[model samples]
Target: MRTAYCVDTVRAAERDLMARLPEGALMQRAAAGLAAACADLVGRVYGRRVVLLVGSGDNGGDALYAGARLARRGAGVTAVQLAPGRTHAGGLAALRRAGGRTVAPEDAAGPIRRADLVLDGIVGIGGRGGLREDAARLAALADGSRAAVVAVDLPSGVEADTGEVRGAAVRADLTVTFGTHKPGLLVDPAREYAGSVRLVDIGLDLPGEPDLEALQHADVTRLLPVPGAESDKYRRGVVGIAAGSARYPGAAVLAVAGALRGGAGAVRYVGPAGHAVLARYPETLVSDQGPERAGRVQAWVVGPGAGDDAGTVAQVLASDVPVLIDADGLRLADVGAVRGRTAPTLMTPHAGEAAALLGVSREEVEAGRLAAVRELAGRYGAAVLLKGATTVVAGAGGGGVVRVNPTGTAWLATAGSGDVLSGLSGSLLAAGLSAVDAGSVGAYLHGLAGRFAAVGAPVGAHEVAEAVAGAWRDVVRG
Candidate 1:
């Protein structure tokens, strides 16, 4: 797993390590790593013109020390200090001794414009809101430059913990982060600013669980449900799907296509579109008796083009099995009934649906996705999966780490793709995983499948569903 901790946790870890080490030792280690990455980025350090955007804190000191290292290697380096009087005394002296000059903000435009590489150390992870006026001006200058930019820790003018871009920020070609990954580095719109990320170890030991996590192939393999020799179809678990309307029967076909490959033993389709489902997938067990009268199922997937059927949503919510709500079900389900459920409820909502549930505009949810998803989970007492370019999953309990899915392609924005995802996740719920696990793993597979299906062309929802087995095998074999 690729793990990320919030700013407070990283600060605590840094303090503990700094206490045991000698004075200035940690900064030296950080500077060494930064200098090396800068050297590689510029292709050569000798005779190269480098400019450092130095600020007030240790984040600036890191840039200054790194500049000093570059100066000693025959590079012409200059430091543009944002805070002249408050600059790190040790770092400033080192840079001057090594033949690097310090320039005021007024004289920085020429050097910044002519630089081979620009290092951004103006703001660190603890920075909040937007960039200050002078910093914003410097950011704009960098934005207009041709130099390859490298950011220290994270890009400026972004919420390091929330991935929110408040105002003007530096767009870097690469970011060199220390210790562990920050939440912003792994998410967007900050992630969009951070082109590529590389982590440097400074030996800060973090304790307990991380604040967020992104699962890799090894993690997905462990979560996959594999049938044993002793396991029968009934023992494996059954998934019941209540979906589709007379008006839109293609939804039932697409959802069934996903569930058939979702590792469930059997798929029981209970809805008005039974004929449409059987025509496409003859393997499905068709039923018109509603969810309650349908034979025993370990879990239920409701909504997904049921066309505003609140009665079907209420009936499924009253069941003893775990349930996943999507599409029309997200809008039509009773808030009281959902909050009172003893069984697990996983809700998958796009930005518009999430906005409706939270009583906010769609723009608000898009702007602060991390906060919105967590708030929805807290209010409804259910696991929530907010789908977009970055798919985030939040567990029912408030304040725990939210899982981010990092494997999707832009082609996943097509119609009926969400319906396929809902059915896939619900089937995993029947296969005995918790709501959080099912949602995250399902998203992981769904994304990889989309990539495989699209392969530089437009892929429909049914094609994405068909590629799930290939993604499953890739994870398991690796």
Candidate 2:
């Protein structure tokens, strides 16, 4: 897992390291990494024009020292000091010693435009809001220029802790962060501003659970449910699905389509469209009495095309198994009953449904996705997966870090795809994974499946479901 700790955690780690090592060692390490990355950007740093937008903090110090390295390597480096008097004295002297020149903010535009690379060092973790007037002006100038922008630590004006951009922020082509990853680099708003992120290890040795994590292929493989030699149909897991209706039998088929591929031992279907589900998947055990009467299951996937049947929803919630609520289930849910359930509940809400549940506009939820997901988790006391271009899964109790699904594609937004995801996640939940892991792993598999099924073209929901085995195989292979 690629873990991201909050800014405060990063700071604490850095402070502990700083106390153990010699003074300014961490800063030197950060500068060396920054300079190396810049050198790679401009092949043969010799004679390349580099501009540093220096601010008043250590972030600016890092840029100044990096510019000094570039200057020593025969690059023509100019430091545009935004806060002349407040700039790091040692950094300025080092740059001057290394044959770097300084230019006033008023005289920076021409050089910034003509430069081959720009280093944005306007603000770091200490910054609260957007850039100051002078910093914002320089950022705007840099944005308009053709220079390849590299932000040190983070982009100027972005909230390092929350990934929230209060106002205008620098849009970096690459961000070279120090110590560990920050939340701003993973979540949206600020994440949109951060282009491709590169982490430079400064040996902070951070301990404890991360504030956020993005699962890589290896992490997903470990979390995935794989059958053992001694496993049987009942021993693996049984997923019960309460979905579909007489009006929309396809929903039932699609939900079962996903459930069958979920690594579950068996699937039990209970709904009005049991005949259609049975026709599609002969392995499914059908029942018309409802979810409670459908007998035992390791997990329950409720909603999909459940329509307005509150009785079925109530019965499903009554079960003491892990429950995944999606589609129509989200619409017909009794909030109090869902909260009062004994089993772990996971709600998968698209932006529209999330907005309705939160009593806000859809645009509001989309704009601040991190906040919205956390708010839902806190309110419902359940694991909440807010699906979109960027899927965020927030766990209950407000302690664990929210997970951001990075493997998402625009193609996965097709019809009935979510039903497949609900089944897949429900399967994982039944397989004994925690609700957060189940939701995140399900997204990972669904995205990989969509990509495999699409293959540069459109694909139907059944094809996506069929491709799950291949996706799982590929993940396991890696």
Candidate 3:
């Protein structure tokens, strides 16, 4: 797992390390890493023209010290101090000693335009709100530059904790973060500005759990359910789905279609569309007696074109197994009942449904996805997956970082795609993965399946569901 602590956690860790180490050691480590990354961008340190957009805090200190390192290596380094009076005294002195020229922000435009690289040190974790006038101007200047921009910590003007861009933010080609990743690095709004991220280890030991986490390939491998030699079909667990109706039987078939391809031993589907589901997937155990009589299942997936079938949704939610609520099921839910459920509950909603659940507008959820996911998890007391261009998975209990699905394409936005995801995640839950693991792993697999199904072209819901096994195989093989 690639863990990301919040700003406060990072500060605490930084303070502990700073207290034991010599003064300026941490900053030196940060500066060295920044300079090294810059060297790779320009291909050579010597003879390259480098511009540093210096601000008021240690962020500027980091850039100045890095500028000094480049100057020592024969690079033409120029420091454009936005707040000269507030700049780090030690860093400024070091830059001058290493032969770097200092220029005021007013005189920065010309040189910045002609430079080969621009280092943004206008803000760091301590920053609040957007850039100040001078910093914003410099950001705009850098934005128009031909140079490859590198952000010192995070791009200036983005909220470190929430990934919200307060107003205007610098868009960097690369961001070099210190100690651990911040939440903004993995989320949208801020993530959109942060082009690429590289972490610099400063040996700070963080306390408690991380505020955010991005799963790596190896972590996904460990979390995925793998059948053992001694494992039988019944041992693998079964998933029951309550979906579709007489009018929309395709939803039931598609949901069952995805469940069959999922790593479940068997799928028992109960709805009014039993015939349609069985016709498409003969292996599915189908019943028209509703979810109450669907027999035992390890997990239940409810909703997906369920229409106004309040009775069906109520019956499914009352079950002992973990339940995943989606589509129309989300509409018929009583927030209190969902919160009161004893079994693990997962809520999968697109922006519109998420907005309804939170009593906010769909635009609000889309505008601030990170905040929306956390709010929903906190409100409903369940694992929430807000599906969109960037799928966010947040645990109901506090203290876990949201996992952002980076593999989805707009092509996956077709009708009934979410139904497939609901089925896949429900199957994983039935296979005995925890709610959080089920949602995250399900998202990862769903994205891979979409990519495989699309293959750079448009794809229907059935094709995406059909490709799930191939995607699972690719992940296992890797």
Candidate 4:
């Protein structure tokens, strides 16, 4: 699993490491790695034009030292000084000694326009809100340029802790982060700004639990439920899906389709769309009765196209088994009842739904997804899966490390896709994973399946659901 630490944790680690190391040793190590990464990106660095946006922080020092290394290797490197007087004096002198020239911010446009590469060292990890007016202009110029932009640490103008890009920010083709991955580098919209991150370890040992964790293939494989030879249908666990309405029967079919492939022993579906579900998947245990009378099920998936079905939602929520609430069920479910449940509860909401639940605008949720997910989880006393560009799962009571799903394709954005996710996660819940694990693992598989199904083309939600088994097999094989 990939883990990310908050700024305070990272700073503490860095300070401790720096104290133990010789003066300037840590910076040199960082500079060397930065230079090496830059060399690899700008292949055949000799005679290439390199522009470094130097500021008044350690990030500027890193860029200057790296620029000096590049200059020694025949690149015509130039530093654009954002704060001339306050720049790292030693780094500036070192760059000058290595034949790098310096340019004022006012004189940077011409060089930036013709540069082969741009290093964004304008701000460090501690920078809050957005860039200053002068720095914003430089960021704008960098965006307008054709050069492959590489951000030092993280992209400038992003909230290091929250992943919120309030104002002008640098957009990099790659980001070379030091020590550990920052929470901003893993969460969006800061994640979006930091394209293709490359971690250049500076050897700081971070302590305690991470702010966020992202599951890899190995981790997901370990968590995947595999039945033994003696396992039976009931033993494997049954998932009950209480979804769909008379108006949207496809939601029921799609949900059942996902549940069937979700490693559950059996699927029991009870809703108005029983006929549609049975027509598509006869293996499903269909019922006309309410969720309370649907017999035994290890887990229940409520909502999807459950239009105005508050009664069923309440019935499912009252069950002692773990429950997953999604789509229309999210709307009908009671907060107090959800909080009072003794069993694990997982709530999956897109940015819009999350916004509504939080009594905020959709823009607020999308802009600060990490905060939104954590907040919702705390409010409901349930695990929250906030679905979007970067799907994040926060555990109940709001304070555990949030799990971020790294695998996904933009093509996964389609109708009924979330309904499929609800079923898949519900099945995992029945299979005995914790609410957070079920949500994260289900998201991982769902994302991989979307990638496999799309393969650069548009894909239907049903197609994504069909590809889950393939995703599962791939994980196991790896």
Candidate 5:
């Protein structure tokens, strides 16, 4: 699992490490790592023109010191100071001693255009909102250049804690973050700006649990349900899917498609679209009786083309089994009923659904997904899986580390894709995984499957469901 810490936590760690280390030692270590990464990106540092966007903080100091290292290697390094008077004294002295030159922000455009590389140290992680006008202009210049732009710690202008890009932000080809990964680097919006991330360990001893976690293949593999020699269909676990309406039968078929491959022993489906589901998956136990009479299932997946079936939604919520509410179910399910449930409940909602639940605009949810998901989870007293460019899963009561799914593709944004996810996650829930685990693991597999189904082109939701086994195999193989 990859973990990320909040800015405050990371700052505390850095301060602790700095107190124990010799003066300037910690910055030197960071500068060395930053310099090495810059060398690797540019291939040959010799004779290359490097431009450093120097601000008025330790981030700017890191860039200046790294620029000094490159200058010593025969590279022509120039520092473009955003705040020339307030720049790090020691870093500036080191760069000047190493044959590096400093230029004002007004004269930076020409050098930025001609430079082989640009390092953005315009703002540190602690800086809020967007870049100031001077820094924003330099960021714009760097964006228009042919050079490989590398951000120091994080891309300037993105909130390190929330992953929100409120205003102008630098778009880096790579970001060299020190000590630990910031929450912004792992989530979306900010993640999109931070093209590729490279972590540089400066040896800071961070405290407590991370703010966010991203599951790797090994993490998902361990959480996945594997059958034993004595395992049978019922023993493996049964998933009940109460989905689909007379108008949209494909949702039922798609949900069942995902459920069958989700390591479930048997699938019990109840809804108006039972005939459509049985026609596609003959093995499915179909029933017209409500979820109450759906015959003993370990877990239930409600919603997903369910329309306004509030009665069925309430019935599923009243069950003792772990329940996953998605699509239309998210809208129909009562908040009071959900909060009162003793069993685990996972609510899967896209930005829009989440906004509706929170009584806010969709734009608010999209801009600040981390906050939105956490708020929804706490408000409903359930685990939440907010589906988008970066899928995040937060546990019940909204207090632990939020799990970010790092494996999705834009191609997975098809019509019935979320329905497939609902079934797969519901099966995992039945297989005895917690709401957070089930949601995160299901998202990981679903995303990997989506990648497999759509290599580079568009794919249907059914194709994505079909690729789950391949994704599972790949995870186990690793």
Candidate 6:
């Protein structure tokens, strides 16, 4: 698992590490790693034109010292002072002694424009909001140039804690982060600014749970349900899907498609679109009766295309089995019934549904995804899966690291995708994974399948459903 820490956690860790070490020990360790990454990025240090954006902090000192290293190796290195009078004195003197040159903010543009590489050290994690006027202009210049822009720690003008990118920000080809991964580097908004991240370990002891967590193939593999020789159809787990209406039969078909590949022994589908589901997948056990008479199931996935079916939502929620609520179910289900349930409840909602539940706008939920998901989980006292570019899964009652899915494509925004996700995750729940595990693993598979289905062009949601097994194989085989 790849973990991310917030700014405060990183600061606290850095302080603890710094206190035990000698003076300037931590800075030197960080600078050494930064210089090595720069050498690797440029492919060579000798005779290259390198421009460093220096500010008034340790980040600037890091860049200056790294520039000094490059200068001694026959590269023409220039340090541009963003804060002219307040630059690191020791770093500046070292750079000057090693044939490195210093330039003011006005004169810096020329070298930055023509340089082969640019290192952004204008702002560190402590700096909030966007870049200042002078820094923003330099950022723009670096972006427009052909230089391979590398940001130190994080991109200037991005919040390292919450990943909120305000005004102007530097977009880097690579961001060499010190110590551990920052929350901003792993999430969206600010994540987009950080092109490819390279972590440079400077040996800081960071204990305790991380602020955010992302699963790898191995993590998902361990969570996946694999049957033994003694396992039977019922023993392997059965997933019941209550979806689709007469008006929209495709929803049921899509959901069943996802459930079929979800490691479940059997898929029992109950809804008005039974014919549609059976036509597409003959293996499904179809039923037209209400959920109470739909036979036994280990878990239930409701909604999708069941338009305003309050009775069905209520019936499933009252069951003693795990339930996944999506689409119309998310809208029509009673909040009190969901909260009052003894069985585990997994609420899957896009920004719009989540906004409606919270009485806020879609923009608000999208802007603050972490906070919105946490609030939703706490409000309903159930596991909440907020689906979007960054699919976040939070367990019931909040207060833990929210799992963020790393694999996905923008093409996943297509219709019927959410239905597929709901069915797949519900099957995992039936297969004996907890709400959080089921949601995160299902999301990981669904995203990888979407990428496989779409490739470079647009593809149908059915293709995505078909590709789930390939994704499953890829994860397990790894």
Per-candidate total of colliding backbone pairs: 0, 0, 1, 0, 0, 0
lDDT for position 408 in model 5: 86
Better of 1 and 6 by TM-score: 6
lDDT of 4 by residue, 1-478 (tens): 8889888998899889989999999999999999999999989989999999999999999999999999999999999999999999989999999999999999999999999999999999999989999999998998999999999999999988999999999999999999888889988999999999899988989888999999999999999999999999999999999999999899989989889988899999999999899888999999989988889999999999999999999999999999999999999999999999999999999999999999999999999999999999999999999999999999998897999999999999999999999999999999999999999999999999999999999999999999999999999998
Give the 10-residue window scoring lowest on summed lDDT in candidate 1.
397-406
Cα lDDT tens digits, model 1, 268-374, are 99999999899989999999988889999999999999997888899999998999999999999988999999999999999999999999999888878889999
Q: Model 2: how far is 393 from its true place, Å? A: 1.8
Colliding pairs, model 1: none
Per-prediction TM-score: 0.97, 0.94, 0.95, 0.99, 0.99, 0.97
Candidate 6 RMSD to the real structure: 1.3
Which candidate number has the best lDDT? 5
Give the whole-model CA lDDT for all candidates, comma-separated: 0.91, 0.89, 0.88, 0.94, 0.95, 0.91
lDDT of 6 by residue, 283-392 (tens): 99998888999999999999999997889999999999999999999999998999999999999999999999999999888767788889999999999999988888
Sort order, lDDT high to low: 5, 4, 6, 1, 2, 3
Candidate 5: list runs displaced more than 4 Å: none
lDDT of 6: 0.91
Tell me which residue pairs clash in candidate 2: none
RMSD of each: 1.5, 2.0, 1.9, 0.7, 0.6, 1.3
Error of 4 at 204 (Å): 0.6
Error of 2 at 275 (Å): 4.5
